[model samples]
Target: MLAIPVLAAVITIAWAADADIYLESIDKKFFNSLNKIESIFKTWFPKFSFSTEYHIENYQINSLNNESYGLLYSGGLDSLSSYIKHKKETLSLISIWGADIPLNKTKFWDKVKYKVTQLAEMDDIKCYFIKTNVREMMNENLLNKTYLEGEDTNWWLSVSHGLILTSLTSLLPIKTLIMPSSMDENEKVPHGSDLFKFMDYRWADSSLIYDCNLSRHEKIKYLLRGNTQYYQFLRVCYTQFQDYNCGMCEKCLRTITGLLIEGIDPNKCNFKVKNGFLDLIKYYLSNNIILLHSEIAAWEDIQNNIPEESSIEFSFGLKNLILMIIIIKRTIKKEYF
Candidate 1:
């Protein structure tokens, strides 16, 4: 259990640096799955592709202790949708401060704690808080300085988050671990979370399931359709600038656009949408200042939700934003994917 997560925390770094992985003992299932997952990533992200040998002293076989569903919850829409989708079987909800809030951000974790506590208490679910510095297990500055070639590159987004977050659940006994899909199945971007499916169905006796059947916008629509009050606890922001969804980041803006497309005021969903915020998005896109790596596919999901004939706020801003994302991808960021 200890060695598996530690290996996950560093495996991508090893792959990127072409360094070999040496482990004392690893679950044979996970080791085998890593090879397949690595191959898939090589096809998805060829720029960082590198092969490495795995030296394991012992390959142990493990089995599930019980039948229970667990989810990697972040109080975000994706996890919220996953929770609602499997709420009947989901007995355990796992949230790690290290993954997003960071170990030292006690204040931020308090906001997360309040929301998750309220959510679990309302749903009669078990919530576990794993506080660690696992996300800080690597020197990200050094990783980027060595690897980033003057473009946007996030260590957590493109490489280390999915496996490391899922592996932390090993500390608890779970039958199946559910990781929220960050993109639609049709999206072709190379994301670290996209590899979760290859790691599915086996890890010792526990299974890792990443569901991509529903797009992000579709998840929002599902949440609305379920008519559950649990959606009130959504926390979609990863930045340190706010208590919840900072409605200006590219992620928050995209999510805000999705919510607006569904006719819900973002303020009702843990985000503060100030006046003229839609114009701000237009300004950034018009000036070619993309707020983040711009998950073009996610933006495309929002685009698809808007009808071609409807000339609403989301329809117009999303139109130009998608164009900018496409232009950036084709001209500037094509080589990375």
Candidate 2:
């Protein structure tokens, strides 16, 4: 059996749940960094009490190679853009099955794995496949009702995933680890994956690197510059039922709208939209079918990117789509606020 990130992974869940951990041995750097992480998170989320107690017998850490870097590749715009930016460097691509795609969804994961492997191979970068039940390890329903009830979210978003996902790569002998940003650095939305200012979340000497200075709109701009071949593998669907982008879902529609605003075709970006695709997107936006709290900023970014001079006049054009999105955003403010 391979060495797992047992101690590091458990501590992440423990932080949010305020549980006591009894681990015999763990990475020394991880132990040190997590202490700082607790302070950082507490400052960001002052409402919750994260008073986790640790009981460790010994410390076991790994040596570092300063130049080696590993990336958490999800085949999404952010990861793909990150890969494109760092293609010239020595990098390893890591993908986990249980996160985003369910462990039982082997068919979907196999396809994602194969596509990610091809991308790695093309760039002469090494690839690692991880399978873990991290997401399933804790009782979300119980946590949501108790420790996380006031949060209005489960363990995944408000806490757990940032360290949990990064911890899974603890066994990958690299000094620097990279995970793409879901929200921009400026966005005030509180999420588990938001960058920790006090810590890089070191585990076995490896440190997590989060560069969220660029917004989602800015990353999609990278795709427009002849990064075409990789576009076929883009997966931003809201469901694992689809192999690629489901243009109907809010996520897919958001990306579609972003690309459309940037003069990129959705069909070329692995999205197959029907006749009423724009209308469907409008319906989702108007009815609040998707989680709007953390999502509104991205939509606002897309809306702001729509050129004021655009007069395409088509349903999918900036003229109509921006108008619809603006109206829906106003409605969201009235309802959500």
Candidate 3:
């Protein structure tokens, strides 16, 4: 396993004062901290260098500025499509991986690593691979009741990445942190919403951090626009490894369903399960009741009209009863597995 030297202590001590102060008081200190991080990166990855011509801009932590664009790249289909779509305006790509997990253990880490390396080779953009001690960070912050809730692991993780990027921005001449989250991801019950909201809320609450922005719908539209080749490389499943996606997972089911709705065949991807199509149908039937209600509510709000019979409501009521019976049976048998 490759590891960067312990620069965390140096960063903590050097930026103690800046970290203590609210976002407003730490411009110079933040810049200094960023310089240190960049220096460490230069030592660790000598081939990588910051762009000489770029210029840095300062702002209140909550303010959105052009210089604030950095992508929380995950090497997934959504992120990859968004990145390719906005390649021209993007300043940098940032990825965070838990040091304990190893790339092979994580579902999409290898794919992401490969794509980022490819993108870095293009010379049009800069990619930063941030290794995080996630367990350590969680442990250190766990005493705080907010962190204990674990309401949004994704957002919390992103904020952790954001902090690193913000520190990097402090050193580099870039503004605007561009994250490619989606509207679907933001919707209730969707994957990683807790984490996304956590990062957004924390950044917004901070008096020191400024100009954080997320491009959800815009990125979606960009991907929807003729990016067929780019779409082929997207990986969304949380299971399976090395050229195959476990289609039964929540992510795989949703991706395939959406593609089908858009008239695309889910089986054509580089990764997929043998029974992906049937799995998607079965999952939809099992989960559709609640999902339909949520979708209907959203659609109703947009249309400003009621459905003739509220199919979602009827379906949910029926499905809830069935699910409850299943849970009861499992509890009775002590066969939770």
Candidate 4:
């Protein structure tokens, strides 16, 4: 591992000495070192301006100002909605292969590419779909090996995407990265040390991005105000491939369930899916998945009831207990079981 200091920020890079290293390069240690580096930089450079952009390489980056912004695109409803709603501003869309929801037995690549092109045309904006050698980078960074050794592929994928996005930002002029947030985390959910620890490890890791800035209400407002058709096109399921969503999968369940509580019919979505989706509502209510944050918020909205103090504390206690159980199980199993 080579530690390179840039502007007082210590950047650590793990080099592959052997044939090829995958996922293993980005381990807990690497992320920890990254946090240390970011801490140092924040102390020194209190205020910094950066821009975001996407391109095949780092071409034409110099033409952009330091304040210009860019966003990650997956041709999903979130990205599409944001693009259409923020059309007045010049935004660049960055894309990577295999980072989106998995669509089975479908030519989703073509559909996604078409969607990007169509969005660019309709919005009269410039969209850049840059393909990163993610697999290769992971191999070089040895993150692939780490992921293979680790059981949490979903978590690793988020880390991989974060590293790639951060690297892209370094190559561009952007200093801040925007991500979607849920109202549960921001308003209703009770404050707990465990919750903060989880978020700090996942979303607050600076190695994943320069400065990750998530806007919960802003994203909701954007979706509410933007093109309704565009919002309807957001795809949440990754396990199905039939042009529309499966609606039964975890992602679909979360999205549809949230929309249901928000008084929106899932059927109105461009993506078609199974009907008995409501059956899974109970399951979602029971499961402790992260996406449930939005679902809970939607539920509160539907009931038109503010979360009582006891209800908030109960939710937090439940989440914390779930986390503790998970940790205990993983420790006993010696894996992310």
Using lDDT, give the best candidate's number: 1
Which candidate order results from sorting by TM-score in descending order?
Answer: 2, 1, 4, 3
Q: Where's the lowest-lDDT run of ten residues in candidate 4?
A: 1-10
Q: Which candidate should be chosen as best, given TM-score against the real structure?
A: 2
Candidate 2: tens digits of C-alpha lDDT, residues 166-207: 878876777788888755544554567774544566666566
Superior candidate under lDDT, 2 versus 4: 2
Clash number for candidate 3: 23
lDDT of 1 by residue, 259-320 (tens): 76665657778877775675766664555555344466566566666644433343223344
The RMSD of every model to the true structure, in order and in angstroms, is: 5.5, 3.6, 13.0, 12.9
Q: By summed lDDT, which 10 consecutive residues of candidate 2 come out lowest?
A: 310-319
Give the residue spans of candidate 3 off by over 4 A.
1-69, 99-111, 120-124, 140-173, 184-222, 239-244, 267-269, 273-276, 287-337
In order, how many clashes per candidate? 0, 0, 23, 21
| Cα misplacement distance, residue 165 of candidate 4 (Å) | 2.0
TM-score of each: 0.82, 0.85, 0.50, 0.52
Off by over 4 Å in 1: 44-53, 145-152, 185-188, 198-201, 225-228, 291-293, 307-337
- Clash list (residue pairs), candidate 2: none
In the range 21-140, model 3's lDDT, one tens digit per residue, is 222222433344345444443332222223322133343333323343566566665567657756777557776665323444555566657766676665467777766554354433
Candidate 2 segments whose C-alpha is farther than 4 A from its true place: 1-4, 16-18, 44-51, 149-152, 183-189, 223-225, 311-337
